[model samples]
Target: MKFIDEAIIQVVAGKGGDGAASFRREKFIPKGGPSGGDGGHGGSIYAIADRNINTLVDYRFARLHRAKKGENGRGSDCYGKGADDIVLRMPVGTVITNAATGEAVADLERHEQKVLLAKGGAGGLGNLHFKSSTNRAPRQFTFGEPGEELELKLELKVLADVGLLGMPNAGKSTLIRAVSAARPKVADYPFTTMHPNLGMVRVDQNRSFVMADIPGLIEGAAEGAGLGHRFLKHLTRTRLLLHIVDMAPLDENIDPVREAKAIVKELGKYDESLYQKPRWLVLNKVDLLPENEREKICKKFIRSLGWKGKSFTISALSGEGCKALTYAIMEHLEQESGIGNEEQIT
Candidate 1:
């Protein structure tokens, strides 16, 4: 199925049924009181989160949703039947917003989460309700209330434990493929990944974490450069970020250090909190480097940046130095489970 992260839809609740206006005519009684019944309530509209869904592609073609109207009231003091509610199933990490107002309505993060999008109209009163001692033989009846209608914007963000960040063809996809079972399209050209791909990285038999590989980002990604903010939002939910740098770039035009700085700058511009997330640098494509010069280059890179955090060197294609990197990430995640910022990552 095509991955659609954003969509616009209109939702309308059902309208209430009209009240009945009737009087009883008996053979024995000359004039009887009003015997009209009240109307039933209309159906409501609800949006629910389901884990089975990962995109908003279903809403792409069908953008309008409406509930069923209530049945009309009947005579002889009999009420009308209420209409059934309409429920819309969406992805677990969907964020619903009001299109006109630009206000967030709901943020569904867990499975089975539900939110009421539109409320049903109330039922109208019958002529019998207005009948009293002073006002006998009344013929008053009220109409049903109108239901609520709204236009909403739905956006989906992938939920992952780890996120891979780097420029195009920086070995991010290769690293994920080596660790997880996800088979993403791989090519030598830039921008091979159009959308974000999710994979499950198993550290051991019982321990595992979700990883997301988003499209490559350029220098001015925060300002809508290259893939822009569309793909960057997917990284907001990650607990750990792996900054993959191509130690051996096929194109001499790319600079590993400058690329890393540019990605960090973009992150800071998009969200200040993202800059504070736990991040580790990984120099990929170590197999391309000469064995004797690998250690020297690693030390020079670290010294040039004056880095203080952890770092690793690995070749994603050949799986060299991958085992150690994965174990280290698992340990770091365990130690800082609840330490840093608890705000929503994306």
Candidate 2:
């Protein structure tokens, strides 16, 4: 299935049926009273969060959603049949907003969570309700209320424990493939990843964390440059960020220190809170360099970039230091359980 994170749709609730205006005329009876039946209630529109769904592709193609209208009332005090509600199943972590009003409608973060998108119109009163001592034999009847119509925007954010951030061809996908079952496209080129790919990194049978590797960033990413913040926004839900730097770039012109600094600047420009997330340095492709020069280059770049957090050297292709990295991430996740921005991602 295609991964669609954003979509726009129009939702319309059902309209109620009109009230009936009738009078009974029985045999051998001089006069008869009003026996109008009330209209049935209209159907409502509801959005339900489903764990089985992971994308908003369904809403992308089907832009309009309408509920069923209520049945009309009948004579002889027979009430109309109520329309069934229309329930729309959406992916968990879907955020719904009113397009015209620019207001948030609901955030379906958990599985089986539901939110009312549009309310059904109420049924009108029948002629019997207006029958009183002074208003006998009345023929008063009311029309049904109109249902609500709204244009909505839906956005889906991936729920993950760790996010990988780096420049293009920084071995983010390779690292994920080495540690998890997700196999994203890998090649000896820049911009190989076009979309975000998620992986389940398992430290053991029971200990694991969800990791997301989004499209790589470049300089001026915040200003709509080179895939821009379209992929960067996915990192907002992650608790930890692994800033991977290509220590051994095949292109000699690309300086590791400068590129790392550019990634940091772009992240800060995109979102300050994302920039402030718990970020650790992961110098990738270490095996490509001589063992003697690995430590020197890592230290020099860390010093030049003024990085104060923990750092590691790993070769995503050779699986070097991947175990330690995954172990450390799992340990950090355990220690930070229920701490920081740890939301329940069902």
Candidate 3:
């Protein structure tokens, strides 16, 4: 299935049915009394979150959703029939907003979650309601009201326990592949992974967590540079972020410290809250360096970058330090959720 995170659509509710007006005509009686009935209510529109759906491509093509109008009222105290309601199924983690006013209408985080999108108009009154002692034979009746129409914007944000970020070819995808079963495209070129890929990292039989790897980020991403912030929104739902650093670059001219700092700056510019998230450093491609100097190189790089947070040295291609990395991440996640190592979450 295609990955579509955004969509725009229009919804129209069904109109209310008209009221019925009639009078009795008897052979023996000289005058007849009023006998009318009220109209039926209109149909409404609702949206539901389904776990089976993972994309918004269906909504991308079908942009308009309209309900059937209610039946008209008739005579002889007969009320009109109401129209059926319309229900739209969307993916979980979808956020609905009013396109015209830019107001957030709903945030669907759980499966089977439902929310009202449009409201139908009320039914009109009949002549029987106006009949009184002074006016016995009433001929007054009201028409049905129109339904509500609106345009909405839907955006989907993937849910994950951890997110990976770095420059292109920085081993973000390789790290995910080494830890989990997600097999995204691995190439030497930039932007090999166009969309977000999720992986389930099982530290043990009873402990596991979901990880997401998004596209790479470059300098000036907030100013519409290099895929922009289009993929950054996916990381908003993650509890932790792993900032991968290329310990050994193919080009000797590329400064890993400067590149790492630029990526962090771009993140801060794009979103302060995301920048402030619990982020750690993962220095990858350590196999490219000598075995004896690996520790020295990593320490010097961290010192040069002035990073105070936790840092790990791992070779994603050779699976070195990957197990320890996964175990540490699982422990951190459990701590955040207020769970202990002896306690099983599942």
Q: Global CA lDDT of candidate 1, please? A: 0.88
RMSD of each: 3.8, 3.3, 2.2
Off by over 4 Å in 2: 338-346
Cα error, candidate 2, residue 15 (Å): 0.6
After superposition, candidate 1 runs with Cα above 4 Å error? 338-346
lDDT per residue for candidate 1 within 299-322, as digits (tens), equals 888777666788999999999999
The TM-scores, one per candidate, come to 0.94, 0.95, 0.94
Backbone-clash count (model 2): 0
Query: Which ten contiguous residues of candidate 1 have the minimum total lDDT?
Result: 337-346
What lDDT score belongs to each candidate, Candidate 1 first?
Answer: 0.88, 0.89, 0.89
Q: After superposition, how far is residue 33 of candidate 1 from its true place, in Å?
A: 1.2
Q: Each model's number of backbone clashes?
A: 3, 0, 0
